[model samples]
Each structure stands twice: as structure tokens, then as C-alpha cells.
Target: MIGDLLLAWISEAGNGTIADFRARAAWLARTENLDLHESATGRWLRDASALGHCEVDWKHGKWSVAPPVITRLPLADGLAVLVGARRQRLLRAIDEEGVYAEQARRLGSSRDIPPPCTILMPYERTRDLEEYAAALGAVYSGCAAAAIAALLGTTAPAKPTAPPAYDSPFEHLSSFSPQTWAPTLPSRPNPSEGLHREQVNGRWQHLLRREGGWYATDLSRGVFAELARRGETVIRWRPDGDHRTRTGTVIVDWGASLPPLQARALVLCSGFVPRFGSAAETSLYDNVPREIAARVASSLGQTLQTSS
Candidate 1:
């Protein structure tokens, strides 16, 4: 009873993984009390394999191997190999003269891996299906798949095909050149405005949010420190007007969104000697030290005076 249920499940599934087969076995065991032991199931498969299979004949003397044959019937010129009620037709276009006859071709395999339950017959038996199936228990298999592969070369293994040369959509990006400019941070803001954070010499500070604008507070500090080094006490820092006020993560949330290059442009246009601390510090540009920068900050502070 378990074997019958197991065979039915295998037939229904067509092909399934070992896990799926085990699950089905457990379910059958629980529901029907029919325990299909894995070992028993394996033995049944082996027995089926020995009993018979199917085959196809590509051409006379040139046959296509099929599965183990359960039955073979001689047709007009060619033959038909049947395994478990499934029939494979092999063509033979030759006459009764036995001279060079027409060739025959087998249909493609019905399944991808054809389930371990089913085996693919070799090409030879299809020419004379009955004799070949009878000789199954006569020979053990050898390991020369390459020769078999050559015969089954209808679908060769895929090789890396040379890709056609095509231009990338962003190929023009290579033409873009990065602009370079000096940086100048303001020391004080028009007597009414001051740095958001204390100006520390030779150090990058925090980020700043002012007037609904996001500024790299570190860049501002570095600029101020550079100004101090040059004895430029009177300085003006102008945050870029084109930026979101929320402080965003450097590389992740908002790296490209911030106009670091535009900030450098503003500083360069302002005509102040720009200073830089190091390469790492200079990479982040967000504000310019200009006359309006100080004046605007000062005006804002006066309008909304903060005692802190």
C-alpha cells in the first residue's frame, strides 16, 4: 500500500526534491498509516529501472538513446519505444531495400531534469529498441560523458557570447571635469552675527543649520581657521541658499544632494583668499565667506535676538 501511494505521488509530482518527497511520505504515513520507508522507496525505483524504459532512434545505425525501455514496437521502417505507457517515436525514412534510408529524429525530453524516477535512454537503442532494452542488464556504465555530449550536441553548453560593443548612457560623464577653487571662511559676522559653532584652529567642526539652509559647519570652521592663520580676522561666511536645512548623513542620505561644488564657486566668486586644512576637510564645501553672508546673518540675529 505504501509503495502504491509512493509511486502515485512520484507520478503526480513528476519530479520533486528529496525534502518534498520526504514530506509527502510523512503526510502519507500520518494520514493513511502507510509508511513508505525511504529505503523501500529507493528499492522500488531501482526495480523499476531494471524492468524497462524508453528510447528514440535519430536514424538507422544512428540511434538516439532514450530511457530504459518498458516496450518497443517495430513501426513501418523505424520503431516506437515505450516506457511506463509513454511512447517515443523515431523516424526511419528508408525503403525496404536497406540502402541509405531517410533519417529519424526523437522529440525533445518532456521534462527538465526528467525526475530521478525517470531515466533518459541512450541514442543507440532507438534504432532497434527491442534488442537494446533486452541488453540492459548486460553492461555496467562507463565514465566518458564527453563522447555522449558530442552526440547530444544539439544543445551545446552555453559559452560566454561576446557582447556587442555599446556606449554607456553615462559615457559623457567622462568628459566632465571637476572644478577646483580655494576656500575662505569668515572669522566674524558683521559685529551682529557670529559663527554657529566656536571657530577652532585647524579642526573641522559640526554641521550648521541656519535660515532654513544646511551648511557644512566643518567647512565653515576650517575656513575660519585658515583665515585666522592668514591674519584675516575680519571674515564673512555665507551659507549656500540652495540647500535643505536638515542635517543629512554624509555619504548615504545626502551626499550628492548638497551642492559642495556650488559652495566653492560662491567662495571663489566672492574674491576672498580661500584656505583649506587637508584634502579630507576640503572635500566638503557648503558655504562662502562674503559680505552678504555676514550682513544677512547679522540681520537675522538682530531680528530674532538670542541671548545664548
Candidate 2:
């Protein structure tokens, strides 16, 4: 089932990095209120590649659907792979008695069943086969309706919709503040001045607007100092662990707001903030606010001069 979803997304997206796939998967989870785990997307991508349904470019770190001729897998081989993957999960679940107990109850077996660990005791792997089969059948039926919808094209890629117009850019920022990180303004005569001092005293920051909202990261913290300095509501995101070196590469949940025009500008001018140890920064999208765009261009020019 996951394999089918992966193929369909890859086909529609043409080609993308694992990060791109994960981003889209995150969006789907938010919009559809489904339990589409990001880790599962990466796992299924590898599975698809292994099954010859997709091709991976190791050097470029991109994936695309394989040629039709090489995409077919023998039914028995495919089933073997599915069973092997699922069996591992079942083995892990055997250690959690609550899982089997829930399944047993769902399968209409109210009588006290053997503990999950005991169900697969040494040399008795098939002792509870009937109970396991019933549990699996129940799960299958629960997802059958959604699976049919997915197969029938109801789960197509979302179309980019127009963002609503705002009287001021600040209003636009506020509209997405709930999903993205917005700075808490100080109660001062000139909040911008106070915010500027705070940001400059901190480490450099990076920002990117993708899908529909902004994602910001700072070397020392996950704040959008520059945007905050401008009284702009910038969303904040922190990496899972010590991932400061690859801050720009992290994927985050930015909600279901699809402000395409602003998102496109951010994508086109993604280099506005230089990466660590790199002297690259520029604004390529002209539609961005003039003052911010000018500063980005000026910063890039200064960097070029210093490097020269």
C-alpha cells in the first residue's frame, strides 16, 4: 500500500530528493489528518528502489520512477518482500502485550488470551495463528475504503491555490503565524530597534519559505532575527539534535497554508542567507519586499568583494 503511494507521488512529482518527498508527505499528513509517518516515507522509498520500481541516483541523492521495463516484480517476489517487512514489525509488537490485547478485543475475542510474549513462545510460533489472522483481517478491512480511494486517484497531488490579498504585509505574516514561528514583540517605543539588537547579538540565521509557510533556523537558536527585526512574523524550527551544520536541510511541519506566490519567491531566492562556511547570498525573486530584497543583494555584493 505504501509502495503504491510512493510510486504515485514520484510519478506526479517527476523527480525529487528524499527531503522533497518527505516534505510532501508531511503536507499530506497535515491536510488529510492521516498518520503518514515521515520515517515510513524514507523506508518505503528504499523498498521501492530495491523492488526495481524506482531508480536512485546515489551521487545526486534524487529518485525517479524506473523505466517501465524494469519496474515489474514477480508477484511471489513482491509478496515475499512485503511479508518479510511486516514480520519484523510483528516480532517487535510481540513484546508489547497491550497491542495484542487490543487486537484480540477488536477481533471479538473477549476471553483471556495468552500474553503476546507467550503467543510466540519457543517452538510455538504458529500457536495463535488463527487469532493473528483475524486481527490482520480486521486491520485490512479498516483501511480498505481509504486504499480504494487512493487507488482511484482521490489522493492526487494538491494543486497550488492563490493566497488571499492583505492590506499590509504584516497581515499576511499574521495569517500564517499560527503555523510558522512568530516572534513575541517587546513592549517598547521602538520594538524594531530592540529586536535588531537581540538578533545581532545572536548568531546568524537562515530562512526558507516552502509549500506555504516560512521555516527559519539560527546557528545559536531557532529564531528568525532578521524577520523579527523588521517586525515580520517569522516561524521558528529547531533540528532534532545537534544538526546545526545541516540546519538548512531540515524538514519541518509548516501546516496546510499554500501561499504559492510567496513560496515561489522564497524558492527562487533561497540563497538569501549564506550557509555556514560559504559566502553565497543573493535575492533572485523581484517580488519580495523591496527593502529586504535590497539588503540581501547588498549583503551578497559585500561578501563577493570580501572574498575577492
Candidate 3:
């Protein structure tokens, strides 16, 4: 079935569409003795999704797997070139185990370029058509093959690793040095011309009239810093009601509370009540973790002990 083929392709190739997958399943059944019927295929795919493998669909043009699979199987022996290419695009829309393996293709490819401190890829990198294509191909050809081989009962020798606590797959990501980074703040609105002007740094310093003339702080900065310090490198942003709170608290996906064990942090700024002011106040939050609760409790304990 179509779903079976897609699942096999996803399992074997990492991603595939209905037609492309069906064609491959037909070929594999006929040649490789892989008994993947349509019903069986769908069942396998459902199983794969339940087990956390991402389902990827490509709707562009017709494609063939026989030739490329044969041609690059040796030199580019590990990656899932075809599925990797298409899968990265899907990563933007679907969280799929939260890592978004397809999108991480570029970060692996551009290992030289220091990654930005944010979760989402920069607009320029994500929008670049050619770069995305290359990333897909690289991932497909590099990793997909090894994944397939492992599925087919082939085993490669394992590599050594550092200690468990010290072993972080994304340890390289933390090597970022903000000193070498150049700031690119968005342009601010001009009250004089009644339009957005080149004003920047709209943090706590910027006074807002819409906020009842209350000077606002950029809560994102504080949150980001806090999470980073706590080792939560990934975060998602959610806005709070302006009437309720000036800044929003950070939360994990699926409405989970911010974990004391920080892995990542995200900043949300929706429904913030704005106040009109002479200067802009956009630098309040930096979206990093601050460990405020622990710090506050520690200070309170010290004061109580002194008084007693």
C-alpha cells in the first residue's frame, strides 16, 4: 500500500511521499524479498509514527530512487539524501520529536558558522532556497543510508564517548562567543513621522504611552539569560495578556510548566500592553534563564538566619 511504502521509505530513507514510497516498496518487494503489502505498509508507518519517526511528504515533481540509490550508495554511504532534503522543510511545520532532525542538517553542514543563540533559524538562512536544498541532499546521502543499514540488520562498530554527564550531543552549540557577534535589532517606530524609524534598543529604557506611560522592560532578555544559565538551551515563546502581566512566563511545549531542570528556553511576547513614551524600551528581556526562584529563596534564607 501507499502508506506502507511511505513508512518503509521513512524507516529506510527517512521520508517519502505516497507515490514515491509506493514505487520503492514495489521495487523492494520484487527484488529484495521485502514483503511490504499496502496494508502492511500502513500498519508499519503507524507504528513508526507512534515510535517517534517523522512522516515526510513531498509534492513537487516525480522522482526516482533506483539510480541515485545505486550511484551514491558507496561514496555518500550514510545520509538519507532524498528524504533528508524534503524532511527539513517539514521540520519547520512539525516538531516531530522536538529535535527537528531535518532542520539540524544545516547546523551540521555549517559547523564552521557559529549558530545564533536563538532556537529558530535566522530568516535569511531558512529562506535561502539553494541552501535548504543542499542541506536536504547532504542529510539524505550522509545519514539515511546508515539508518537503513541498521534497520536491515547490519551493525557498525560503536565509538567511544566522554563521561555521561559531560557527554552532550549539542555541547558544540554552547561554544558561541557573543563578542564576535554583531547586533541586528529591528527598526523602531517614529512618533515624529508617524512611522517606523531606525530607532533601536527599545528595552526597559523606552517609555510607552500605550502602557499608561509605564516604562516597560524587555522580559525576553531576562528569560533567555535565565534559561541559558540554567542549561535550558531550547525555549518557545508565548505571550501573556497585557492586563494581567507586563511580561509572560516561559513554558515548555504542550502547556508544561518550566522545568527546574533547564534544557532550553523560549520567549513569547504576545498581548503585551504597550505604553507610549519618548524613548523605546525593547531591551528588557534577553530570553535566557535567570534561576530567580532559587536565588530569591537563598537570599530570604540568609536574611531569616541573620535575624534569628
Worst 10-residue lDDT window for candidate 2 reads 70-79
Segments of candidate 2 deviating more than 4 angstroms: 1-3, 36-38, 70-308
Per-residue alpha-carbon lDDT of model 3 for 47-157, expressed as tens digits?
232122333222232232221111111121122112212233343433432322222211211112111111122222223323433433322222222233233310111
Error of 3 at 22 (Å): 1.7
Give candidate 3 regions above 4 Å deviation: 1-15, 56-308
TM-score of each: 0.19, 0.23, 0.17
Say which candidate scores most in lDDT: 2
Candidate ranking under TM-score, highest first, comes to 2, 1, 3
lDDT of 2 at 73: 11
Evaluated against the true structure, the overall lDDT of model 3 is 0.26
Cα lDDT over the full model 1: 0.27
lDDT of each: 0.27, 0.30, 0.26
